[model samples]
Target chain A: GESVGLHLPTLSVQEGDNSIINCAYSNSASDYFIWYKQESGKGPQFIIDIRSNMDKRQGQRVTVLLNKTVKHLSLQIAATQPGDSAVYFCAERFNNAGNMLTFGGGTRLMVKP
Target chain B: GAGVSQSPSNKVTEKGKDVELRCDPISGHTALYWYRQRLGQGLEFLIYFQGNSAPDKSGLPSDRFSAERTGESVSTLTIQRTQQEDSAVYLCASSNRVGGNQPQHFGDGTRLSIL
Candidate 1:
């Protein structure tokens, strides 16, 4: 029964403020975690990913933090902008499961200009 | 230069009708995946294909759903006698390999609606 879940359904923030989205996963053996952003009428786009070996990974404007003990993962976005408003999803891939990804209920990030 | 591509951006069909959705993975990619996204939901894994190996169809919901891939390139997902519950966006993704860490690039997806 592997599952990934988010702490919030919606996150609202000011245009220039920082944003943090939280996720909780039940599978301890999952070795890979990724965050994706989906805009209206578009597919999920890969934003950042973190491996079990590392606690954190940073992308251009995003960072993913992984905490194995509590089975928690978080995505932090700096300088949130209107273009950054979208639904964000966290996914996990168990090392033994090939390339199958289990996605979590998405968190919608709303940036108010 | 191109990413994954799915055909018929939109499809509306009556209940019980059959539909075929196509996917064109990136060139030279050996892994392909099919996922379903319902309204206001996350992506649901459906099936996966890697190279010449038998596909992993464990995620397929029912016998009515089946898929076929020619080599490692194009793939087609067919739904026979579709039901209203089957209405969802069918997404196709591909990665260079089947490794756990490899990222999968997705297509825009084909929106399926059952009337």
Candidate 2:
């Protein structure tokens, strides 16, 4: 089994404030990374992604940053809202042979109003 | 455009029973994958299908677990002799291709409980 754990650190932000969730991956061969959001009773939904060739990618209200040097990935959400409350996951894909994604432990974001 | 869909949203069976979870990937998706997530845990890759190559069953917990995908469409994950530890949300995802920047689209997942 592949094990990719999170940083075990969470960020709590007030409503309307920006939030940043971080992740650490172990495999340096990982060539692709993605951010997913999972709400209660649902599977993970794609939020944004970054290829190993690039460092940053942004969406409507979300952004993903990858630092290859440190094998670190981060997701930033602007003006975080209650709807943003959920667990965030960062997955890494190493090599293209199988191209399977190994996911991180996940971070629970709490947006307090 | 329809997203990936899964079947039977929920299932409950006694220990030692067998259960099958299904996934219908988005049309035109050539790659499908199966994963499991225990309560409060992250996703665990189970298998991968690219066009027709051998399915990657490396992450499958044991021989009791197997999956099959017909053509480039629906996929089924079977768990035999279910145990209490088998209770979890079985997730399915599909991608446009095997490599590059394509994101894997996921279904809501099938929640399975072994009583």
Give the candidate number with the greatest DockQ: 2
The positional error of residue B69 in candidate 1, measured at the CA in angstroms, is: 0.5
What DockQ values do the models have?
Answer: 0.46, 0.49
Poorest stretch of ten by lDDT in candidate 1 chain B:
B99-108
Q: Show where candidate 2 strays beyond 4 Å.
A: A1-10
Clashing pairs in 2: none
- What is every candidate's alpha-carbon RMSD to the true fold? 3.9, 3.5
lDDT of 2 by residue, A1-113 (tens): 21122333466799999998999998998888989988777778889888888989889999888899999998999999999988888999887655689998898887898
Question: Looking at model 2 chain A, which ten-residue stretch has the lowest summed lDDT?
Answer: A1-10
Best by TM-score: 1
Candidate 2 similarity to native, TM-score = 0.93
Per-residue error (Å), model 2, residue A5: 13
